[model samples]
Target: MSDPIEAAIFEKLAKADPKNVGGKSIEPADVAKELQPEQWQRMLPKVKATALGLMRQGKLTITKKGKVVDPNNFRGVIRLRLPTEAETAAALAALPPVESSDDDFD
Candidate 1:
């Protein structure tokens, strides 16, 4: 598994965040961009694969293999939401206030 890509995959699966509310643990994609230059070059694909593995295990259910699945609805493109105050502000500022939607239940 010396191929950079495979190495990356291992790194991703080996180190992933685990705060998924739906019991689906966070996978490598969550930290894909965060990987160092060398790490990214090699492990990005791996992380993506790990993400898919999570989905395969039913830890997550999204269209894309390595992506954040909707917590409430798993039939669409769902990405992870940040919990930091900075992230909250960013998300809110990025979107117009949703009058009422089930997506915001979290």
Candidate 2:
């Protein structure tokens, strides 16, 4: 399948993570700003979808209040990041996180 959007999201996440410390995480808007400063509104949903795909693949995690969340149904603000290696493989194999129903980025 085509994955240009996913690839771009992953790249931006990687670049953003070095600054992601103390449970702070990256938001889709951050990626959008870095990759599409002038078109963030258009780019955000795609970024969320791509991030969900990554989370399902065991490459990432979606969190709210520092806890892993059901990406498909979470509400309010959330953050995305690589899943900790210490987690069981099963934890990594859960259904993928879904795109947020509301805009969650600043």
Candidate 3:
């Protein structure tokens, strides 16, 4: 199984280039780059947020037992399983529609 934290860190370092991600196309610069100690420290929360966003968007989930759990609980060094179509649909449907804060503007 793949590691989600490594994947996300790869995504960040790779600048989200699809070509540089996955399989033989993987690049050393993609996942090899590491932030400075201080920067890496600051990035922990952002990394968690990104993981959560991916989960909420139904791209990934936490595998517990035989089912996927919400990725909101994904902590450090954990991998997230990709969600199925039905699971993604359910997740999307459960979310409230986006609201416009400027809707009342004249």
> Which candidate number maximizes lDDT?
2
Better of 1 and 2 by lDDT: 2
TM-score, model 1 to reference: 0.31
Give the candidates in order of TM-score, highest first.
2, 3, 1
Candidate 2 lDDT by residue in tens digits, 1-106: 3676666656766676665442446777787676678988898877787877677677777888889887568776778776777432656656466667786678
* Pairs of colliding residues, candidate 1: 8-43, 9-46
What overall lDDT goes with each candidate model?
A: 0.44, 0.70, 0.52
Q: Which of the two candidates, 2 or 3, achieves a greater lDDT against the reference?
A: 2
- lDDT by residue for model 3 (1-106), tens: 1755557554553454445432222222223325334456565655556556666776645444445555545333543445567778977987789887866656
lDDT of model 2 at position 79: 80
Candidate that beats the other on lDDT, 1 or 3, i.e. the better one: 3
lDDT of 1 by residue, 1-66 (tens): 544533553344344434333323333454565565555547555555544444443433333365
Root-mean-square deviation per candidate = 14.6, 11.9, 7.9
Count clashing residue pairs per candidate: 2, 0, 0
Candidate 3, poorest ten consecutive residues by summed lDDT: 22-31
Off by over 4 Å in 2: 18-24, 86-88, 95-106
Model 3 stretches with alpha carbons more than 4 Å out = 1-41, 64-67, 71-77, 98-106
Error of 3 at 31 (Å): 7.1
